[model samples]
Target: MYVTQASWKSEIFQVTVGFLPDRAQIGALGLVVLAVLASWVVKLRRRLAYRRAVRPGQPVHAARYGQGRGADHLGAYAPQPGPDDTRA
Candidate 1:
């Protein structure tokens, strides 16, 4: 009617281990891992193919930054020009 803490812990451990997966479950887990690896391989192949298709020594088109007047408006630390400022 009254179980000690040690015995109760052992009982819980036995129940937990009893619920562990069998060989079939382990095989299913392996299959899932293989599926994920295959997906990553396919993605890597596509990325490699795209990189190969791009010509070497050609500049990749990307947005140019800090070229416009708004570049100075980024932070409070940036210097703000006044109407009377004459720095050319």
Candidate 2:
């Protein structure tokens, strides 16, 4: 089957124009975006509330503070023993 360039161009234009969103579709998309934004705001508020609830003087768990081996309670890196160091 042989198709001309003009026919292809017309088909492309028709597809593009036909797929253009209507008012209802645009409104629905706007609502979805607003809902997502509202949910994110709610989550942020909840996180802020949690932070406010926590006391500054409260001691945190040692496991929560450390990363790898020999890390201090404050998540700071501590020096590991070398082969030359005789101290056990």
Q: Which candidate number has the best TM-score?
A: 2
Error of 2 at 85 (Å): 63
lDDT of 2 by residue, 1-88 (tens): 9975668866775566557678755776577689989999999999999997795887776754435344333344656668996644
Error of 1 at 45 (Å): 0.5
Candidate 1 error regions (>4 Å): 1-21, 57-88
25-81, model 1: which lDDT tens digit per residue?
567657768998999999999999999778599777665774545535577876777
What's each prediction's TM-score?
0.40, 0.40
The candidate that achieves the highest lDDT relative to the unseen native structure:
1
Query: Which run of 10 residues does model 1 get worst, by summed lDDT?
Result: 64-73
lDDT, residue 14, candidate 1? 53
Each candidate: what lDDT? 0.73, 0.69
